[model samples]
Target: MTGTPRRFLVTATPPTTNGDLHVGHLSGPYLGADVFSRAQRMLGHTALYASGGDDHQTYVVTTAQRLGVDPVELAARCNREITGTLELADIDIDAFTRPDDVYRDEVREFFAGLYSAGRLVRRTWTFPYCAETDRYLLEAFATGYCPECLVGTCGAICENCGHPNDAGSLLFAESAGAQEGSTTEPRDVEILVLPLEEYREQFTEFYRRRRATMRPHVLRFVDEMLSRPLPDFPVSYPAHWGIPVGIEGFDGQVINVWAEMLPGLRHMAEAARVRRSPRTPAGVWAADSGFELVQFLGYDNTFYFSFAHLGLALAHGGLVEPTAIVTNEFYHLNGSKFSTSRRHLIWARDLVGKYGPDNVRFHLGLSNPEHQPADFTEAGFLETVRTRLHEPLQALATALAPHTGQPVTVRPETEALLDRYRDRMRRAYTLETFSVRQATETTANLLALLAARAAGDPGLAVAGLRVLGAQAAPLVPGLAAVIESRYAAATPGTVPELADLLPVTV
Candidate 1:
């Protein structure tokens, strides 16, 4: 282990207050951040994991209206559901602050400060107005019939026809689920804009520097953003649904989610400071904080999370900058994007209800979609549960249980094997590389080796099992107790050879 552990600020926004979290949510930044935070704690580091419910978006208000309840009540109900779901999945968030409640003033200051400094500008742009919502549609809701292929779908671009259309170019639906009887409307609204053009050269340099210093996938994203046409749209909306802009003239307007949402990062930074121990490292609060801020998110949020938000946060704030933005591409389910509307996604509740949190945790670690789109199939779920969680760990526990019959000597080779596992885990957790496949592969190889070792040599196998049973005891205390009770009276398995499990890679 390293001499001293590094402090971390791990932050992610909870799913929309109106939406239920699915497997995609589990496998995305939230899961990744949870794994990273847990690993940091395991390594004896101070890691602050902060998350908050997003209750200010138009979707939340519209969803609430459809249910014939106030948006605040609906947001509260959904927040409760979200908290329950995450807790059941063992997502132990250190702090769960609601954006609308605890972070509103912070977000307001963020907007006003930027605007007063001339960093924020205003512009007019066309947006899709939903009669049902009585508000303009955000990018997430706007969809149309494909003028090319004529397939009406629920995406900014048509999936069936593969064509792109603006709100005026196609027939508008009242709600996302709006049928033929759905109401439609178009309204022009004035919105405040964040002028990214002024910072083009600065962003180019910042992004290029980030690309040069970061992992390859992160670098690729930097290159993509640098080459894309700059978005010159208003960062604030004339709608009453989001965090209100504090500018004197923009009372009714709310800072759009993109520009306003990143204040959540700073809120977490301050919260971490408040939560940190007195002896905590000074860099955690230093103006030029050396600690990296790694943001995890899905591919759909790449533009905002990967580039735009990072740039905005760095440009607007003074404390810490986003060092590594670790965004996964996506976790697709059933050959399509995991959608709450389509019911194609697996909710965390269902999985947690069936098995347990630890089991689900193992699956999340094994199936992290850090790179390209990864599939989450029922077969994959069953296989991971059986092989990775149930069978292998159970086998190790059983093999080690009987070895404690006496004060057994710790074998040097066995200790070395445990050290190897520790080192691999440390690397995977802190190295912050984009190669999750490699991490899982290494974990698999180690587990397979342990299983084979348990099957083979008596003395070394027993000692190895004992060490694993010891190390994992703290993390999974219940499983540890079970292992100690059952295996302490038993004996090690007798396979012909020990070399089968402990292979020399060199």
Candidate 2:
């Protein structure tokens, strides 16, 4: 709310060290965070963009074994692939810190602090056993065929059926050899646990209070996830590829994936602490510190991220709390879940090469996956580019070509339109509740108006257009520059190519 842009810690999972980012990953979580981060910077907020490769667990090791490569070597290769993918998609994070990043020390300290506070419990838990690897599988690598949707990788619960199951209930076939329902050996593993029941009353109170202030759609979700009793989290895993458990007694076990994710906030907080200066923005570290911490995640990860924050609060008496969390449902492509194994993903690299980043960004931004699954079609892509980014932006630039050097005066209509856009963007953070439908609709309407206005008064619209470019440039630097350059070229006889502007759209 301060005129000074509040310091924000924007975070997302670092791509797995094995492959490039797929359309589902981009559309659901990364796309929204990218949009929000870029927009925030345009609004003058000091935001530290942080992300890293999820290099731990059995999946990485199994993939390595399948490829006949060392696990560490495989992870490195995957990390590079993901980083390159993100860069290609125009996701310019400030620090793409990997698991090996210096932040691990902070993570260990954070864990140690929690343990010192009597918040961590050591417990022997039953985990999915993979006889092939002769090791216990973290939920990250565990999958079961959904009895309802009949999809594999349903893990401990069948989301399609909304039915929960214990590890013993699901069948585990070999990775490359086995028949369905064939019984495999099971392994017992020790893992640390974080009890969230301690804060049930606190979460209930917090939700009740937050409900009064948040939009109805958001409260409905909070209620659904909170309706059940909180579960205990296994903080450590038996896998050799992840962060080692900090507990003194839990040797040979890596921290669980859920535990791996909890450190992102603290990592972000430490990043902010390092960047803090005399003019440092507030709310970067402290829970009640007033800074907003927004997380963009998929529906599958809801229970983990949702309670992770509350559990963190319960662990630490007075730490900073997550200000807002945006979780989206799955993204379907041509009526099926986008899958890499089946070559079903609309690769970000391929799409960017074809239509450009700006178009991809615009399309995903418009067809947001915040509320429910959103479809991405070839026709829809072309329509968005033709109507939204290419025509209107070019037309606006063309109209303003004659007035570049003059002390430009914005027409009333242009001023009013830009003013409305500014006002809408002013509320972007407020709409952080993961209702992508609402946010996308609101953003699309503004963008449509922006496109129309640009085409309406090319000459007199220079100042207004440049102002818009400046506001958005912070987020999409390349696109903003493209807009500014094209507008400048509009002087008298010069006009930038429409194709050149397309790159910014991705």
TM-scores, all models, native as reference: 0.81, 0.82
lDDT of the candidates, in the order given: 0.62, 0.62
- lDDT tens per residue, model 1, 1-506: 47776767777755678767887787777767776776667667767777777777666865676677998888888888888887777676776666655688877777778777776666655665666645565534555565546766543334333233444555643345445566656566566766655667877777666763255566665565467555553567667777777777676777766566677666755666566543555346344665667666555455566545655655576656666667676678877888765678888788767766655655665776776677888778778767764566556546655643543444677777778876665566664553444555565566667766764544565555554544443233334445455554455333212111211110
Q: What is the C-alpha RMSD, rounded to one decimal, of candidate 1?
A: 6.0
Tens digits of lDDT, candidate 2, 292-391 = 6666666665555556656776677766555666666677888788776567888877887777676676677677676677788878788876786567
Off by over 4 Å in 2: 1-5, 101-106, 127-130, 145-182, 185-190, 212-222, 246-249, 268-290, 397-410, 429-464, 474-476, 485-506
- Candidate 2 total steric clashes: 23
Model 2 per-residue lDDT at 178: 33
lDDT of predicted model 2: 0.62
